[model samples]
Target: ELKAHSEFRFESNTSLQLVLKRGTAEIFGTELAIDIPYNFNGVKLAVYTYHGAALEITGETIVEYTSEETPMPIYYNLHLALEQRRMLKKSPRILLIGSGRNTASKILANYAVRMGRSPLYIDLDVTNGSTLFPGTMNAFVLDKVVNVEEGCPSSTPLSYFYGQTSISTNMRLYKKIIAKMATVLYKKLEQDEALMDAGMIIIAPKWSDSVGFEILQHIIEAYQVTVVAVLGNERLYSEIIKKNKNEGVEVLKVPKSGGVIDRDVIYRRQEMSRQINRYFYKVDNEFTPYSLILNYKDVSVKKISEEFVAPTSALPIGATRIVDDIRVVDVEPSSAMNHMILALSACEQTEDEEAIAISNVFGYMCVTEIDDAKQRMTLLVPCYGKLPKPYILVGNMKWIDHQ
Candidate 1:
């Protein structure tokens, strides 16, 4: 038995099981079923309850405690307001921007889902993406509730490979990718009225510069964001309100949950490793990925050009040409390919730089080993037999499979 309006927070590096033995509780906004064990691994989360409840736990934890301090009521009130706005508007794009965006994003997503709304969770936090692996900007339609263990659905996500974890690597490409997503999403909303009605919940990339506000303005204009919720930042709230005063956007300042934990670079890297591992093996070893070997001639390995400029189509054929800050140039097989994550592009034509940049990733594979002399590389992919595309893009993204 526990007091109402409290939170049960824990940090676990290994496997752990949680059960709501009595009364009701929730992780984020998704309600937990009574007497069901939810397995978690390498996750730090808080199970919050508005009323008294009893929770049973099994397995090891780095830390565990109950907190009387919380901001659930404030969050709930914001949710209720947003819910009203959602009801009146055909689609209200809600963007959550702040330092503690990940936790806030999860809480808002859970709240929306419980109200029987299917919202799109857009992850711009390339440093720690929730929909796909870190370094990829993705959007997943949370049409169905996720299992507590699963956290977020990975079956299919609208993902774009930025090739780097931080937007600072290619700031120009970052803005372009956002532009492309907006274009793609507009088309999608036109076709799927349900998704339009469901709207979107976007978690912006971690930004703390003048350019950040410009990017936010660009997104607001591109996506027509109706709500901008700034968590734990009164300055940001005031700034956003001042900037978008003429735009008629609702900007709210919400308190960050006291239980939200700060994740350092080391912690983020470890989580990224786990996320990559999960991509291949899944949470419960539900999928067994196949290892495939290929010669240099088998597939085309390409990387973005170092030179950045406006797109040009006047360049010679079969040679790397600049296109919208990036150009696909063929890369020779070398030791550099080892442990690198290559995005499998949906666009088969390797010469189409524009198409490749905007096209959604079909899948991703890791280069586990490279034989320089033989010009052969080993790949660990989710594909069982044959890969659909021959165009693979390499970026700064790399992951060492601990297994």
Candidate 2:
């Protein structure tokens, strides 16, 4: 039996699974399973059981009672506002911006699905790509409530490959991709009256907020955001309010969930690698991706990096070309791309920088082996013979092979 304001904290050791026998509890702002044993790695986090409850556990485990007040019931108001807008025949475009671990987008998404609105969800946080994998900009329309345990599906109607983890790595390319997506979304909104009426929900990256108000303003203008919700930080909310005052935009301040825990860079990278593996190998199916050996000479690769343009004497001009917003540099060390996730450029050839920059990726390829002696590389792709063009773009994305 659990008392009021009590929580059961799970220890990170041998696989620990919890079955909620009788009680109301949540993890990361999402409800826990009733009877099904949930395999949990609740490290440095606690599962708060509101009021009291009984839990059944399997395997060697440790659970401590640590109670704390959480901010979840208040977030329900955002969902209510959207529902109200829907009832009033208005499509409200909602955007959630905050740092990772806070799960700003995921929480709102769960609420949106629960409220029964098939909102178009756009994920702009390419670093982790919360719903999908990293290095991709994706969107989906949700019709039913997403399961708290299963999470959302990976495949979606709208997805564009950026081939990089963070937008900060290539600001110009990031903005260009955003522009293209905005255009596509605008056209889509024009065609589907129902979807347009349902409106769009975007989850911007935390880095965007830290960048400054200009970045936030750009995202707001780009997405034509109607509602801007800031979570966790009051200073950010106040700053956003001051910046968006009288701009015909409604800004709301929301509290961060108790379950939100920040993950380190290593953990995030591991998650990204898992996403890549999942893309190639399905969880519930037997599948083997086609592997190809391609000569390094056949494809042109552009690695996006900043180079110092101004010398010490030309200090006033600036240090790097990225200061001028340059996105990529022509790299010739083709063998070094081993284990890196590369995007197959859509262009017929990689000669045109413009085409490579703005064009969509044919697909992704993970470099498994590199032979400098043979001047060739072995790549694992989703399908056979779908590499499209010879121009492949490599980014700062790297994956650890679990084989």
* lDDT digits (tens) for residues 163-263 of candidate 2: 67766666666777777778878888888877777787787765555455655667788888899888777888888777785476898888775545577
Candidate 2 pairs with clashing backbones: none
Q: Could you tell me every candidate's TM-score relative to the true structure?
A: 0.92, 0.81
lDDT of all predictions, in order shown?
0.81, 0.67
The candidate maximizing TM-score is: 1
Over 4 Å off in model 2, which ranges? 1-14, 20-34, 37-55, 59-68, 100-102, 144-152, 163-166, 208-210, 282-287, 307-333, 346-352
TM-score of 1: 0.92
RMSD list, candidates in order = 4.2, 4.2
Off by over 4 Å in 1: 306-324
